[model samples]
Target: MGETVLYVCTTCRRDGDDPEGPRAGARLFDALRVRAEGAVDLRVEPVECLSVCKRPCTVAVAAADRWTYVYGDMDPAVSAEIILAGLAAYAATPDGIVPWRERPTEFKTGVIARIPPFPAPRPFPAGTPEAAE
Candidate 1:
């Protein structure tokens, strides 16, 4: 019932443009993380390049068993709201599928593609357990 959000830079900033080289994604991720710290379960990460150049800063979310989507050209100011809303929707879904009508069109419009859930994680890996003896 948790989610991980990733803000991917579709295009690296032009040389000498921002000096920081496409920081909107970073800024957005940080804002969202702080806002969702405890109210909800969410994780934010930055990715190298998402390849949607024309759009610039973009973000995406990957849920346990739902459609993976990408949102492009997002304004840093509203990134947190977008992320929090998306997380809420994902958590509410019984099977992690947010209906088309329910999705935020503002963000969903940039969806590059849909992907299945990522590899499952082991509860307790070898050498790491509840009671090691």
Candidate 2:
């Protein structure tokens, strides 16, 4: 129902190496951007950090009315396509809930966090009768 956004930690370096070369997260973002060209429902955004420094090259996927997923320990060169595949599955869902079995192997193993969506309060329960003053 809503757009899926993939947020990558651009400053994350593989193995804590000096950031002289392209960071893995940035490379992943670039690859995903190229793959998602002309896509309206899926978007790629670069971020500075996601607090998963221990697992360099992290990414978080989120969407309105859906659970958010944070993945870590990613190898951008090899994981980019897998991440996109996972995002595709997420975008195809009405609530962005991609089944564990359906997720790409990289995502399946790299998932660092799964956060529940913020609940929307209901005005009233179904089948309730109208209140009279």
Choose the strongest candidate by lDDT. 2
Q: Model 1 scores what on Cα lDDT?
A: 0.64
How well does model 2 score by local distance difference test?
Answer: 0.84
TM-scores for the candidates:
0.67, 0.83
Cα RMSD to the true fold for all candidates? 6.3, 4.3
lDDT minimum window of 10 residues, candidate 2: 124-133
Name the weakest run of 10 consecutive residues (lDDT summed) in model 1.
8-17
Give me the displacement of residue 124 in model 2, in angstroms. Answer: 13
Candidate 1, residues 16-132: lDDT per residue as tens digits? 347655466666666766877777456666677777666655777676666677767666667578767866887787665688888777656756666777667756655765436
lDDT of 2 by residue, 82-131 (tens): 88888889888877788888988888888899999879975665566742
lDDT (0 to 1) per candidate? 0.64, 0.84
Q: Which candidate tops TM-score?
A: 2
